[model samples]
Target: MAKQSTLDKNILHFLGPKHWLTWLGMGIAYALSFLPWFIQKFLGKALGNLHRALSPNRRHICDVNLHMCYPEMTIKERQSLTKAHFESMGIGVFEMFATWFQDRSKTISKVSFHNEDVVEKALSKGKGCIIIGAHFSSIDLCGTHMARYIDVHPIYKLQRNPVMNWVMERQRRKIFSKTIERRNVREVIKSLKQNKAVWYAVDQDYGRKNSVFAPFYGHECATISHISRLAKSTQAAILLYDYGRTEKGYFLSLTELEDYPTGDEVQDATKINQLIEQQIEPKKAQYFWSHRRFKTQAIEGTPSPYSK
Candidate 1:
């Protein structure tokens, strides 16, 4: 833990009037994180409702995504799912704060690992394990718990808000074995060569550069087509890391992909995408739907599905 004096020095940069909202938000998150788990759930749902009411654009994005992905769902069912997703997002906020502020043991105690042996077997190989994850509502928070089972390095993207980004990085640095930037491919490869586990999230559209159109939820979505090459280059085991809430609590596990990286980029991308789609089906609402996932059309000049 950082000393109070050091934390105070860190907060000095955000004392200006423009950063008041960030300061207030951080204070609220800090307080909420320490609340009882049950109370946090209730308050998180309420906050989700409030956020849904306030953000039409984001809500619409979710609505569009849900519709495109699950056309079989009736309008009412989709609407309900959308609202529930927002609630999950709201709860995720609490989880994020708790993850950053609470003890590692507290978060680890709350989660159940379904298949740690899978991870162990992968690590048993001389090569490191390449753990690919999707955009779950509480990835970083729950991922911190999953790390208890395996010493996994997480690659994080920088938040646009520098203040919040700094705060998150500080906390993340403490809990994680090592933190790498999402774009730092060289470091990721080097870590794998060192027989270290790295949790790299690959379920988002990073645009056309080094990406290909792959089937995501039955639609052709832009996906990065480098996992196979990455695996081959690093001689690492490829595993899909999955975590979600269930009737019990949060369940997290790793599924090893055997004989992977057939050395076909498109085929490899499709296989990974299919696995993600199947995994996300049960925890539909917990998946991140607010992102403009299909913003980059597979067909050049085609309009984005999320367009108003």
Candidate 2:
């Protein structure tokens, strides 16, 4: 493990500064996205033309997810949706940069909040709740906006680029100073004890030893057990939050999980996982399907639905 850490550090050092790349990419994308309505329309049409000509990996990811989640979808319908998904992903990339680089008012105006009472109620109890978030549309802004109403401690997996990490750390701290690394389990526990809300993006590919197989999109996938463990230890209420894009703009919604900490850890985790799936199902195109979510397989001799 020490050797692996050293290798990782060396690789990051080799990459050197990444802040310049981030700035250049973000600046160009934001400017393009904010062009005049007529100009932006032309640019969008041109991009659509290019999209039809090129075969992006995002298309494949969308197709795979659609196939897995909606086996009943006809191939033609799936293809059409996959095309729209890639276009949306492209637009979302630019929207992400615009949100990150632009002023808070401009970005926050694009998102609407719903069921804020859920968070207020949790905080009112003075025990702080665990917010389980996923990488859906405009997810980063969810934490940013929530911070305006209450203190939110979000967990992030640091990047390899030291310079880029420093830049992002500064930007993130502007809204949330209590950012914890994924490996800092002790720190997370301490924060919960202090009655601080901790936000976690639980839908990711954690290896077998650290995660348990859970059903997602009708397939068994390795899901993080940390949230369940923390809830069991601290008795914190579990709430799921997601941001979905609307025709007008973006909107945030919170769903409170029923019967949290019912003395069945696995069952509790399964329920939370199902709630996350339910949230993602309606906004399938916005979900980050590029991630290899089912990288870890079920144990040998078990019927693995996700074996690809």
Candidate 3:
């Protein structure tokens, strides 16, 4: 057998008594996975309410985003939307639980696919596909559920908590056809060449590198630009895979973009932001509003609108 390295020993040490609370939280989430759908929804909203009450800074970030994006919205309307965002976020947590412990067949049977012909056509092109994913509520569950329909490889990030990271990797591997590290450009290209759909969330800002400052929701926001490169190199089609929750279960939509990667990076990025807005408009609260979306301003040295 291979000898465990020093880093492995330290991981074992930290995963022991040093992380009791983390373990307890994971345990509770696991146990909650078996609750009936209706009850789980109630408890999830309650948990979200509790979290909203405790997290003022996060709430402030959401408020700032709403003010920027929905300048026309009444303060009352924005406040209501904030509450719904948190509640949906809480319910999203339990959705992860449902995905981890519940029966995949039964859970997926509840999902309805729309405009699936879009994907059918995209795959028919013989080039790979890059799914324009987003950070929406129930992100974990939605990403996992998506693989059921298409042979998708999710571009994943490592959880900050090492112990939880292991858990996430294990769970993703179980549901996803394959998991690709967010930085593994080679694997992404290879998968696309194989005509497999790769899920890529281009909404987040990862500093200025390979990113362009563009107007998103009426604010100058940093947008990832390498997507244009990826699509160009792989000759892969870019499709939007939108997820929505109804009273029954969930629904996903596959939308094929026309005239994308116009060979202009900024134009393509702007189009992405535009498409994301369309996706969020119908389900405002189901989107992740608490993220510091405008952290990186358009101009260098410009102060972030969000409070520290």
The deviation in Å at residue 227 for candidate 1 is 1.7
| Whole-structure CA lDDT of model 1 | 0.84
Judging by TM-score, tell me the better candidate of 2 and 3.
Answer: 3
lDDT of 2 by residue, 1-308 (tens): 12111212433453436356765654576677565434543454456436645855545655676788789999998877666655555555555444456556756666788898998777676677888878874565556677776677888887665544554565677767577777888878888777888888888877887787778877777888777778877877777877776767678777677777677656765776787787877777667765667667777566433343
**For all the candidates, what are their Cα RMSDs to the real structure?**
3.8, 4.5, 3.5
lDDT of 3 by residue, 96-159 (tens): 8877767667577678888877888999999988998678886777676677778899887766
> Which order, best to worst by TM-score?
1, 3, 2
What is the alpha-carbon lDDT of model 3 when measured against the actual structure? Answer: 0.84
Give residue 303's error in model 2 in angstroms. Answer: 12
Worst ten in a row by lDDT for model 2: 1-10
- lDDT string, candidate 1, 1-308, tens digits: 22221223466765799878987889888988899889998998999999999999999999999989988889999889989999999989888888888886775666888888887788788799889979988786778787777888888877776568768878987887788887789989888878889888898888999698988888898998877888888789988888987756788888888768887788888899988888888899999999888889889999999888
